[model samples]
Structure formats: C-alpha cells, structure tokens
Target chain A: MTAFLRRRSLLQGLAGGAFVLVAPRALADLGSRLDAALAERFGERRPEQGGVELELSRLVENGNSVAVTVRASPDEPTPAALHLFMPRNPEPWGTSFQVAPPALAEFSTRIRLAGTQDVMAVAEWADGRLGATAVSVMVTLGACADDLYLEF
Target chain B: MRRALLLLWLLLALPGHAEPRAGQISGYHLLGEELQALQDDDFANPGMLWVDRGQRAWDAAAGASGTSCRDCHGGPERMQGLATQLPRWNSDQERLENLEGLIRNCRSARQQAEPPAYESDEMLALTTVIAHQSRGLPLAVAVDGPAADAFAAGRDAFARRRGQLDLSCADCHDRHAGARLRGETISAGMINGFPLYRLTWEGMGSRQRMIRWCNEAVRAEPLQPDTAKALALELFLAWRSRGLELESPAIRR
Candidate 1:
C-alpha cells in the first residue's frame, strides 16, 4: 500500500513538472518563429531600432488583410529593399520592395493578416546590413470563411 | 392672320428662347486628341476574357432542370444594353434590382441553375455584357425616391470606419486624390472604368473587386463580393460618375 501511494505521488509530481516545462517552450516557439524569419532574411547582423517605422492599428476586426506602411530613416541613405513579415501567418514573408535611390523614404501597401499576430519589417541598406521593427495587433473577426464557395 | 402673328410674337418672347447647342450637356469635358489617345490606351482597349467566360456560362446548361441563359434571353446580343439601366426599380418584385440580383432571379426563374455569388466571375461576365451594351450611353442611376435611399445607404457604407486600421473609403480616395501612396498615384474614386485591367490584378476586374481589395487592405472582414451593400455603393459611385465617359477596360497601376 505504501508503494502504491508513493507511485501516485510520483505521477502527480511528473504531471506538475510537465506543465511547467511545456508552457514556456510553446511561447518561445512562437517568438522563435519571428526571430527565425528575421534571421533568415536579415542574417546575423541585428538591425537598429530607429529610422524604420511600421504603422498599423491596434485592433483589427478581420485578419485577412491589413494595411502597412514602412518609413526609412531620413538620416541614413535610402534603403534598397524593405521586407515585411507576419509571424503567425501561414506564410510569414508578405512582400519585398526595392526602392530606387531617388524615391521617397516611405513605402505603403496592404498585407494578409493570419490572426492576432506580430508583424515585423526589416530594411536592407545599401551596405548590406538590415534594420527591423515589430508591432502587435489584435484581431476580432477572422477572415477567409471556410465555406466561401458554398454561396453559389 | 392676327392669331398667327400673335403666336409668332409669343414664341419669340418665350423665356430665354434660343436654339440648344449641339453637344452641350452639363459637366461635359472635351478631351484633346492626345488626351483621348492616352485615355483610350489607359482604359478603353483591353480583352475581356471574363466577359467571354460569362457568355459561355450563360449558354452552358446546368441545374437539375438543365436549362441555360440562352433558353430565356435568346443570346448575348439580345441581352445588350440590359445592364446599363439596371439596379432599377423592378415593378414585378417591388424592389431595386442590380445586375447580380437580376441574374440570380433569372437563374431561379428560367435557367433552373443555382445563381452565382455576387462577385463571382459568372455574375461579373453577365454584368459586363450588360454594361458593355451601354458603353457610349451616359450613366443614369436614379438617385431620388427609393433609389435615393439606397444611395444614402451606400454613402454611409463608404464613410463608415471599421477594421484594425479604422480607415474609411473617403480617407484614401476622397482625401488623398492625386497623392502618391507607395509607388502609384491615386486615381479619383471613379467607377467609369470598371471590368478594368489593373496591372496589380493582372486581369479584368470589377469595381467591387477593388472595393474588396480596399477592405482587405484595412484588415477589415471583407463583405461577400456581391453583397447588397456593395451593390448599393456601386450605385452611388455610378451616380457620382454620371457625366464621365464609361471606360470599362481601363488599365491601372
């Protein structure tokens, strides 16, 4: 009877330990997805926080598409390319724009939103280093209905 | 002879009596040859593959009853000019009927086929043919009476803000006309050119497609492509572009 009681206590301890171990890892996984996407695109060099701006609303009713604007730092030379990423989307990389030197310092466009997700924008400078920034948005209504074609 | 003289004198004295100028209409802007060329190149000339697809769909048999659009309307030519005046009051139904609504009605009443969704290519094609027939005619959407109420509803929809960004249609199109957004210059929010060939879309698309794209841009749940609200907005836009020449196949960046 003592052995069975000890076994039950051990099982309870294991379950408690498993919960503690797994919860943080799941969150880290989500963060790492964004980090990995940035790492792959921007490489080992970490981008500076200033000069690049990402404008988005705090609340989104639909998660299908969202408007985004990226502005390069005026102090630095105009960025040659701007890359956008949505961490939670099925495809994180939304689009990349190549800006001519004479062009304006800002680029704006629309992007697909997967859900309440973190969006990142990285600017690739002429010298090859990248700059990045991120924002979090809340989504209420999900886009892309399952039975879209069923209306017919 | 005295009565005839009196009638002539009265006709001459009528208020502002003068012969109406030939081609004189309110809000008419004549384009020079060069501008006309540019306008045509930009908007008028393009292949309408979707319209062709719609023509086929109209004739193709479908549904349990196996009927086609041809079974009722005869064919494409006979159905011309039908779309130009649509979204009109349907006395039979006692409601307004846009092109898509009419198509849906026809599908149920005659073709026995399931009606395509509001913004489906099938509906667009049928609408294209109908609008194409009135290519040169001035757009004449009734804005008074019950239709006026629809126009007011549409305007409200256009101005309402929702989504994450909380932007309205007026914010970009009305406020920022002639301004550059990204790489492209914004065009006036005109519906004269629809079923247009946008470089971005890379194919023929309707004004409703553009509206959906805008809704998506703002991170709003886009309404069904052919929603009544969208139709109402189209009616409002059509009224707004009343005097502009219809440029169905215009190109855009």
Candidate 2:
C-alpha cells in the first residue's frame, strides 16, 4: 500500500511535467501564492531567513496534527507578533499570535499541513523589522481532513 | 502414570508463543521521535483533552440516581489496575464485556439513565478516564473457565483471513512486524494505547473503532460495535498484550 502511494505521487509529479528535475509547476505556483499572501500581510518588507528559528520535522508520518515550535533569537530585536503560513493549504495563513512586551518571542503549537510543502513563520519586531524562516516538510501521508478508512 | 502427569505439568508450565511476553513490543517504541515526544508531554499530548473530559464526566452526576462515578467509586485513582482485567466475563449480562460495555451497563442499570451510544464522546471520555487510571499496569486478562470460549474466538478472529485484501491481522502485525508498510512501520497489533488519539482520525477513538478501520483497510466486513464478536476480539487483543504497560489516551500516528 505504501508503494502504491509512492508510485501514485511519482506519477503525479511526472504528469505535472517537471521531469522530476525540480518541484512541479503547480507547487511553484503555490509558493508564489504564499509570497503574495505574505506580501499582503507584511507589505514590501521581505522577511529574512535567519532571525527566527522554526522547529519541525523534515518528514512527518501523518499531517493531521504536527507539533511546531518557533523562537526568535535573543540577539535579534524583540518580536511583537508571529505569523505562520502554509502555502499549499486551503488557507495560506496558518495562525498568528501577539506577543506582549517582556514575554519571550517563543511559542509552540500544533498545525496541520496539506502535503509536502514549505511551512513558513514570520516574526515582526518592535522596531518594525520582519524576520522569517521556512522549512520544507515532506508529509508521508496527507491527512488534512482525510477520511479514516478507505473504501475498496 | 505419575511420569505422564509430570510431563503434562511441564508442558503446562512452559512459556508458549501465545504469551505476549515472549516477544512483546509496545507500539510506543515503534513510534518516531516526534510522536514519542508528543506522547510523553502531558501538556502537548492531544489525547489529554479526552482525559480531561473524562475526568469531568466522572464527577458530574447524571440519571435518576444522581450519583456520579466519583460518588460510588471515588476518584479514578481508586480504579487502578482495573482496566487490565476487563473484557472479562460479565455474569450479569452472561456475556463478555469490555470497559465501555461495563460503563454502559452502569449508566442504564444503576444510574437509571440511557447508556451513551458506542463511539459517542461521552462513552470515549468515560472509558479514557478509567483506562488512564491503569496506565503503566501490564495487561493481565484471564482467559480461563467461563472466558475460554471467547478467548479462543478472539484468537481465531485474529488469525482468520477476511476482506478483499485477503490478509489477517497477524499477517502484517505479527509476521511482517518491523517491516515498512508504506511510510509507517508495522508493529505488533497491541491494544495498550487505545482509547488513544490517532493523528489519522484527528480525534479520540475506542478500540472497536480502530478495529473497524483495520477491517475496512483490509476490505473486510467490519464487526458491528458493542457486539459479542467485537468484545471477543478486544479480549484477545488485551490478552495478547499481556505484560505490556497500558498507555491510555496515547498519541499515535
């Protein structure tokens, strides 16, 4: 059954015409869609990749509920808010939290992933600067609102 | 004749393959690091939500009697080591009954209230609280005397091949354990983690629901919930899990 799913995903990738050289164009489109959503929220401030740390498994067995943690480095400016995004998900915006002053810019929560996609986190500092990071998570099996049993 | 009796005694004392302890393995060790961490973290484990609900249900009074589980049985802590003996013979019902069945019986017979339907949130919550009490206790279900027939039936069910895939529960969980089945590793079909929170289900589930899912996966006709057959299978699974610590409300993929 696992082989069947792997074969099916490979076939899907091939059909998307990427020749397995890179990600399918559909995925690329979703990446841009994420960028657009991020732009709409953060507005012209391109979030950098190193200011904040996003902890997640590179490969997850089930995508239903995955534990994730985000922490802003101490050297970096204090973060005022944090936002999470998943491009391939039905909703590009995962969630957001406002960090009160004197509180640590670190938080942990569980989120659902759509499939093999990038999970991005953005942190807004008190100085109006934005820092972000994204991790590529390969969901072995996509379980976002999935049915429990398969009908033969 | 005395020598023959001595030989029978030795055979009876021998540790047979049916004893789960011989090669027993909990599903927890088979989990990936992430899931293991999740299960270990009481705050982060999603299954705790059900346990909390169960706790509430245990104290809240219901039915004509207005007696809560706590009023009679005190706290869930008092029920320690109780779950390990369940799916046992119920002389009142004159049939085998699991923890859920016992809960249902209490509700209808003692509390004078309609029992919650099988798989209902109320049922799952109540069962979780009781089973959670037995966490870390090894399964030690007795399958002798009046319970022997059900145990034999459960063993047969575990080995019986059904479904379109033509696979028995033992075929994958026993013979092919440790082998990769798709993205996941197959572990011995243990039931210690049940009433667990499964990522695939994204919610709490009873052992019967998990069994039904397995039956469906194999394309076999699932046994109806709360039936004699289902209880028999539960007995078999609990007995097969002998010596394995219970991890109720466990987090699983």
Candidate 3:
C-alpha cells in the first residue's frame, strides 16, 4: 500500500514538472508575446506608422520561408536599428539588427510565418522617433505545420 | 519496305526504347515570381544558410584521423562540376552511390566516424556546400554499361503506377508538366536543384526526402532512404535532367 502511494506521488510530481516547463510558452497568446517583445526592445516608445517601407509578397504560397525587406524612407534620417514582428508565429519577434554607417537603413532577410497575418517592421531613428509599417500577407499554405516525418 | 517501316515505328514506341526528352524544362522556371526572386538573391535565399554551414564544416577536423574534407579533396572549388555527374557506379562498393551515399561512405570509411543520416543537418550542409560548387553545370550521369540495369529499373519505376491515387511519376511530371495543381505549378520533376531549401520543409532537405514526401502524398508505400531502389531512381533522375543547369541549394516552394 505504501509503495503504491509513493508511485502515485512520483507520477503527479513528473506531470507537474512537465507542465511547468511547457505552460509558459504554450499558454501565452501570440499577440501578447509580440507586445512583450516590443516592450522589451523599446520601453515606453510608441511607434508611428509610415516613414518605413516593408516589402514582401502579399500572397504567399508557402509560409515556411518568406523574403522580407524593411527600408527607412531615403528622405528621412537613417534608423539606428530595425525590428521585425510576426504576430501569428509561435515567437512574434522575428529578428532584430543594428544599422550602422556606410550601410543604409534597409535590411533584407527570409522569415517563417505561421499563418496569414500582418507582419510589421519598426525602425528606431537616432532621435528616438520610431517608425513602423505592416503588410497583410495571405498565406495559402502553412507548410511548416506539416511534420517532416510521418508513420505509414 | 512497309513491313520494315512498321517494325521500326513499333520499336521506337516501346517503353524501353522511348527517346529521352528532347526539350527539358528547368524546375526553377516553374516557381512563382516571388520564389524565383527569392532564389535569385544570395541573402534572401535560405539555402545559402546551409551552404554557409557547409563551408565551415569543410575545414573542421573530425573523427579518429582528425582529418578535414579539405585534407584530401582540397578546397570546395575542386568539387566543381562534380554534382552534375553523381549517382554513379561505385566500383569499390559494387553498387551505385548517390551524393548522399558517397558522403556517408567517406565519413564512415575515410574519416573513421559515424556517418550522418540522409536528411540530417550535417549531411545536408556537406552536400549543399559541395553541390553549390557545381551550380550552373549541366546534369550528365552515365546511362550505359554498369549503370544500364539501374537505369532500366528506374525508368520502370517512373512509369509504374501504385498508390491510392493510381498515379505514376510520368502521369504528372511527364504528361502534364506545365499544368497547375492546387495553385502550384507542376514542374517536369527535374532534380538539378536537389539538396535544396524547400519552403514546404521550412529547412534544407535531400532529394531522397523529396521522393519520400511525394510517395506519401500519393498514399504509396514509402520508399526507404538510401536504398537500392532510391539510388536507382536518382540515377534515372540525373539522366532525365541532362542539360538542365545545376541550381543546387536552390530555394523551392
């Protein structure tokens, strides 16, 4: 009887441990995660729309790898850094990069989108002004969701 | 004279004697405009990441011998035009060996290390890096002598229809190459851009992985990777893709 009780307690303990490890990531809403990422990067700064251009195919056939380019208006001052966000992805923070001299305020990269959603890019200027733009992408296939291997 | 002409026409119409495709369509041209652009840009193409990884691994020492690939093969430039001639007859093993099989054998026998699995990151990187060197070369696998039997087997497999869909590779890739299926263009099933980064995969994959994926898509019995059947099919593909420029480590959707 004592051994059975001990085993039950151990099983409960393992389940609790597993929950603790997975809950934080699984439970957090994707939008909140994006907001959290933004807050972490730029505290107390609200970014204004425009002054930055985000270029990508509006209609995506496959959401695994999408080419994206974020460029600050050449007429405007070059931004200090660029931040990308994908709210529909598991992690909303796509990637961040610093913009330095000799290099323009434009950056191009390939990113994964979880589904159809608005992908945004924020550019932080030297004078603390934040400029942003978002593109609504219609993803035809969420290819990444399919597992690489499946049992016959 | 009439009998002789009929016999010649019949012989030409036979499956085994069917001439190779006179005009080949490259898989790259079949991609959507955006995907083509993505593949064009060095920075935007995700396959470059695997190439970068492979470049690093080229010089890194491994195994009991502590020898890098560079020690024997020299720089990756030495591998130029090599990918175009793969799935060749390996006399030492007394069997055909594809790029992945050759790499596996090299690592196991030469490096004295455990071989990387077919679709593993390490193997993909190595294959991508090596194949990237031969980019723009034409496919030219030998189809006679020791390779004849395998070529025949592969051609048979390509035409044989088995699966819930009852579709053969020729039914789609050969008969209707330019037609659209579910918003995606059906390519000629050319393999010049193998060891590529597929948007569907969200990562780099080998040609064997692509074959297995197609089999699953048609609800057919899965073809085990790196097997004799798989190697035969690869040799056949190489022959079919003859004259198509290599776009190894290409971006595909």
Candidate 4:
C-alpha cells in the first residue's frame, strides 16, 4: 500500500510538468499556423518598409474589429494598392484597396482581430517596393468568438 | 378679368406660405435664471469632469519645449469661438485640418513642442475651450470648392457597406431616427451638438468617436480615428446641419 501511494504521487508530478512544458508550445504552434496561412496568401511578395503609414490604437477595448488606417507617406508618390493582414485571424488576408495615383496616402477601414496581436499593413508603392507599419493592440474582448449575430 | 384671376392665384399661394408645421414646432422656454441654473448644473455636472480635466491639461506645460497653452491663446476664455469654424481648409498645409490637428500644429509651430497624441487630454481640452467659445453660434461648415471632392467621398463612404454584419450608416440614423433602440430614442444624425456629454459614453466625445462607436455597435468594423473617410463624413454632417446652433457639452441619453 505504501509503494502504490508513492507511485501515484510521482505520476501526478510528471503529468503537471508535461502540461507546463506543452501549453506554451501549443500556443506557439497556433501562432505559426496563422503565420503560415498569411505567408501562403502573400506568396513571394514581401512587403517593404518605407512610404506607408499604418495607424491604429495601441490598445483596443474590443477585438471584434479595430479601426485601421493605411496611408502612403507624404514623401512617396501615391500608392496604387494597399493590403491589410492579421496574422492571427482565422482568415489572415483581410482586404485590399485599389487607390488612384495622386490619391491622398490616407485610407481608413476596420479589421477583425483574433486576440491581442500585431496588425500589419503593406502599401504597394508606385515604384515596386511595399512599405509597411505594424502596431500591437491589447484586445480585452476577443473577436466574435461566439457565432451569435444580431440583425438591424 | 385677367387681373381678378391673377389676384385669386396670389391669394391661393398665401395660405400655402403660412407655417404648415406651426402646431408641431413647440419651443421649450425657460426663464433666464432657470437657463443659467441649467448651464451651471451643466458646468458642475459630473459629465463635465472630463472637460475639466481637459481644461487643466490645456494650461499645464509639457513636451520638450515645456510651453503651456497659456503661452499662445492666453487661456480658455480668450480662446472662445474657435471651435465653431474648425476643419477649415488650411492654405499653408493645403489640406483640411480638424481641431485636433490644429492643436498639434499650434504646439509644434508656436510652442516648439511635439503635438500631443490624437485623442490626448491636452488636445481635448484645448479643443473644448475653442468649441466653448463658439457655443451659441450656428454651425457653418463649408462643403464647396476644394472640399467638394472630399464631401462627395464622405457621402460615398457613409453609403458603402462592409464588415461581417454588412451595415451602412443610413441603416440606423437616417432610416430609424427617432425610433427607440434599446430604451433610447435615436436622434437624427445631427452634428449640432457635439463634444457632447453622453450618459452612455460618460465623457465628452466628438462626432468622429460617435461614428466609430456606431460602427462597432453594429459589428460592422470601424475606421481609424483620423481616417480621411471619417473626416469626410464629419465634414458632410457639419454641412448638413449648417444653420443649427452649436450645443457643446450637451446632455444626451
């Protein structure tokens, strides 16, 4: 009876240790899944770093959809296209806007957030390089986790 | 005979000119003291505390230059009537500038300081004081000339549909104005009273913030606070209610 009790205690301790080690790996795996989804959609087109401005709140009260704006930097010629992506969202590639040249480098729209995550935008310049900016938003309320929909 | 017929036609037009909606247009009148009491209550109201904090920040100095708003505008009282004609076309910048932008510009150019964040308390306070100055004046936002393109763009944005819920601005305010939504009567999408004190928001929020809230409430996503489309809609709403008197710090359910 004493030997059996000691074995049970040892098994419980091993199980606890395994949980602590595996939980973080699972989350990292989920994150990589999101990144993989985004990469698959974006393909070989790597987003560049200058001439685009992305504006968003550093903190979001709700993550259902946070307002986002992507504009061409004033110095750059107006961008012909702009793309937005949320790496952690179920659907990573969200929306793209086709802009007219000489258009104000300013566009505003909203996007869904899966959780507290980095939201990135890439602006395709008139010249081929894509400019980008990213902001991490602390989302207190997760995105529409439940399937409830309200109709107006 | 011709003159008599003309006289009859003129008489017919007279009755039509008489106020058709006179009976329905009742005015709420209170005595001067009563109105003053209401205004005082407004000032001391807990809702105004946000504005009060803004007032304090407006006078406080910050940034690398360490200059306060008092350095330029000489404080709130002197800066009245400033907010009424905002979002005006700035010739120097060659773009439409809002109150927040103007505050930042003032800090950058006059104070040699970095502009406060877009929604910072300092910006709100300076703007509140400016809006306070134009308190009783009618709203008169210009919608023509170079602003016409922006106005058209804004109107388009208001009409556009996107987001998971697939809703538009008109679906609520325009179509359902005055209808009760969750115990509150929806007022017309009027911009007459802005920087308003809302029991729901519990703070003074601009029309732009309200616009963003509407988007979120409908689960239709939201645009950035400084987005051009939102600004354009703001311009359009300001123009729509051009002759309405400004009612800043107003109480709303």
Best by DockQ: 2
Candidate 2 interface RMSD value: 5.1
> How much does candidate 2 score in TM-score?
0.86
Ranking by lDDT: 2, 3, 1, 4
Q: Judged by lDDT against the true structure, how good is candidate 1? A: 0.64
Off by over 4 Å in 3: A1-49, A74-106, A122-132, A142-152, B1-23
The stretch of ten residues in a row with the least summed lDDT in candidate 4 chain B is B22-31
Clashing residue pairs in candidate 1 (N, C-alpha, C atoms within 3 angstroms): A59-B164, A60-B164, B43-B250
Candidate 3 per-residue C-alpha lDDT over B1-253 given as tens digits, one digit per residue, 9 for 90 to 100: 5345334433443444335563356667656678887788887688999999999888888888899999999998899988899989988777888888888888989999888877888999999999999998898999899989988988888888978989888877776555557667566788989888877767888888888887777778878877788888888888988988899888788
Per-prediction CA RMSD (Å):
19.0, 8.7, 14.1, 23.3
Provide the TM-score for each candidate, comma-separated. 0.49, 0.86, 0.74, 0.51
For model 2, give the TM-score of chain B. 0.91
Give all candidates' CA lDDT scores. 0.64, 0.82, 0.81, 0.63
Chain B TM per candidate, please?
0.72, 0.91, 0.91, 0.77
DockQ score of each predicted structure, in the order shown: 0.01, 0.25, 0.14, 0.01
Judging by lDDT against the true structure, name the best candidate.
2
Which residue pairs clash within candidate 3? Answer: none
Tens digits of per-residue lDDT, candidate 4, B1-253, equal: 4345334433432433322111111011111222223334764544366567767877888667788887666867776665666566676876777787777788888777877765555565556656766767877777778787878877777777766777776555455443445334344466756676543444566777767766766676666666677778787667655666776665443
**Candidate 4 local Cα displacement, residue A1, angstroms:** 78
Per-residue CA lDDT of candidate 3, range A12-43, in tens?
99999999987767546655776787888888
